[model samples]
Target: MKRTVDVSFPVGPVHPCWKEPARVKCETRGEYVLRAEVELGYMKKGIERIMKGRPWQEVMFLAERVCGICSVVHNMVFIETMEKISGIAPAERAAYLRVVANELDRIQSHLLANFSYCYTIEHETLGMYLLDLREKVMDLLEKLTGARVNKAYMVPGGVRFDIGEETRHAILGSIPRIREETKRYRGMFSGGPMIGLRSKGVGILSREDAGRCHAVGPTARASGIAVDCRQRHPTYMKLGFSPVVRDEGDNFARVMVRFDEAIQSLSLVQQCLERLPEGPVLAGGICRAGETVHRGEAPRGELSYFVKTDEYGRIAEISIQTPSIMNIEAAAHYMMTGAVSLADVTSIFISADPCIACTER
Candidate 1:
């Protein structure tokens, strides 16, 4: 199994594996990958820098643009950072509403990632089914937030507006369907021979490596790392959140983690609806000058935002640490271990669920 000639290939700035442009320069020996170098910046917009000196109110829209798949969480993290610094307290109902919106976002995001993973494995029918099911979540979001992708519904004090009676009912009613559909898909993905053959025991990442690389979200959880921002975040803490961890640390495990999370997210959304309090969705508060760091569990993983504000209540600086950067880097290392087949590289990369738009930003 030795390489007779050196070979280099690139999976790239325009590849099916990623929604945004990113390049992976891989060196291979025969059928095995010897090393991999991930090249980002193709989608870089210097988002953090762009937020600097912008009005605090305007930053929310800009933050949502960082990544479409997890836009709601991005706005949530940024808004929470602003709220913490400004000492703005959201109403009890507002908090629950935020949770409802976020969990829905998480469900859709996880489904989208798993669907893409299916596509990478050439499971076209399954991928299409997942995408079609995902549209239901999108429809829910559109009804609640007025947009399918960059829902700027969250704000510093609370949500922009209350969830409509019809929207609330729509969301509540949809949970059972979401849960059922997700469970069925999960069964198909886990029990299918093709998925098991291509994923189980392949692209293995050890527990130690996951910790060393600071892997987050499902990627870290699949490796048995018990680091979920939701368990620690104040909001989910109120909701009695729990982390889903699997010890396998393989491509199959990673995909299954998202499936588990999608179901978990549906349950959470149900709770938010059941326990939603009665009060204004937005609170009244004036922006204050200060600095603070906040954390939220995006669909991907631990999303941290550090905000520094000026005396005029404008954003002075903002820093974001997205999960994809860490997880993808860890996956690259795993691929470079020299045991993985060249053909399996994309499958391994997709399992990490890299969002280059989020990473590059």
Candidate 2:
């Protein structure tokens, strides 16, 4: 059998559906997409190069700037790596507070990703609803960290500040509302006929493909790979964390996994607060000379930071592996291949939740 390409379709380096810039070239035969290729490098920031020779204090702030959506995880992973090298551990109370902040960040990020997917699929009403819920989560994040994005909350030994009693109560009180609304919106996304028709089986990435491509986060989890960096993190282990999984490996599955995880995050936040111990939030440790690698569960997937510090606690070398790198590759190749409609190309790409800023960083 022979398949002929009837047309070439190119999406982005700039597109309305995508917030960042990256180009995808699709070879198609009418409505059926035969192949797709991704091109990056439009938004490279050279952040790693900038961090070299800087002290840990400066690099910590730069780490969070890697991705605005999941900044907390970057800050956490970098600081934790430095702490490990320095043989410093945070107080138990501070550890729990870190988990609470990280989980809240996860919830807002998942909601934002799902909202983008909904908007891409032409479900504007559902998209708006998800964004509204995300705003509430952002409010909670602000309440905890004093900033919604790029929160430089985590430090070498612990966190920047302690969570006040009133902030704790406010976060606890808000979880139920966020969780219930997320559940209802997920129902709308899953049960709506038009949405189902557009997404249920669209952009399927098989488990084997997901594994071969090394997909991470919800992208891999949706394909039934039960890998989560949090599962190995000490604090998350203490809180009984588990990755959400689905067998569908479709756009719908990916979005649903995020929804499930968002709900799960709410529970994790509640657990952290209820079990939070009364103690000093800052353990106060210096970043001593060392080298270490650390991984954390960002909203998109696994985020890794490798750091080497000199005797003066200045960064001698640094490298960051963001989840978006593999997820974007998987989207452009495995997920976007085969008989996909032209209408679905952008939606399928967005489903993997590619972060161009993180990828080109």
Candidate 3:
């Protein structure tokens, strides 16, 4: 004779492990999560609703509020939407500037993720060191965009402000120094003896599962998907940038992918600085028209936007698909495939940088 037992466990907004307002409930008899459910829309601010009747130029400002960590990506999506509808294409200089901003944001975003991963496994000294090094990137962002959180440098037709001659030289000056520093920091954070033990075979994502689940960014890259939106559809095609990808599909692999990307972004910035052209930055003044869609690669993954405009230069409709939206589901696949502690699992979920506000909007 056999017997059956079922137990349900609740984890959420108030859980000691959580930093945000959301929950996951899992029912299980042993180590496996038999039934897992996600509770969402805790902080749904309805940003899209506010867009109705706002000017096309104003949408970038509104979209900037979607995600604090990756707001530059958000602004790009919104601006691209307006550009499509208005039939305006920015100058080559403007395009290069967008690439610079987007790539810089990638460096900051990847640093934060890898640093947090350092903290997750009890590598205290490395975590602190990585975080400190990350400050260099953050300070650069503040200087470039005025505010670190919502960098409104990307406007409808092109960049809002040009990189000044002095600032441009200063930025060029920092590249080699920042590159050497990041390379050294990356080595230190690898946590030689202890890290391998913790993450090497842990939380594996099989290549088949990775593709079937439609993973993106470093997550998908680690799992052996070569789909980088930047290369797939070149928003900055003139720069002739190539996508960086890898295969291993584990915690360590994901770390490598991000680390390489940061180095590559630094190199790209140098190229952009050298090739930074001089002309009117913007394409033209605002022109309101019908609806259109645009998509680009966010630091985390793919981001897309659709905006409808009326003759009055106001936002008639809007829709957005953030990488977080797709990656969140991929994360759920990881959680379901193996047994993981709440601690090892948390940051990757946030690492998706799921802007509940953007997805919910």
Q: How far is each candidate from the true structure, as Cα RMSD in Å? A: 2.4, 2.1, 3.1
The regions of model 1 sitting more than 4 angstroms off are 1-5
**Candidate 2 versus the native: TM-score?**
0.97
Model 2, stretches more than 4 Å misplaced?
1-5
Could you give candidate 3's per-residue lDDT for residues 1-361 as a string of tens digits?
A: 2234375565676644344566665556565655455678787888888888888667778898877778888887778777778777877688888887877788888887777676666676776776776787777766666777788888777887777887778778888987997888777646586777666655567778777767777788877788777875454566676776766677777777888889998988888888888997777756677887787788778788878889877888887777766666766556344545544455445434444555565
Q: How many backbone clashes does candidate 3 have?
A: 0
Candidate 1: how many backbone clashes? 0
The regions of model 3 sitting more than 4 angstroms off are 1-5, 15-18, 232-235, 340-343, 347-357
lDDT for 96 in candidate 1 is 91
Candidate with the greatest TM-score versus the true structure:
2
Provide the clashing-pair count of each candidate structure. Answer: 0, 0, 0
* Candidate 3 to truth, TM: 0.90
lDDT of each: 0.87, 0.91, 0.72
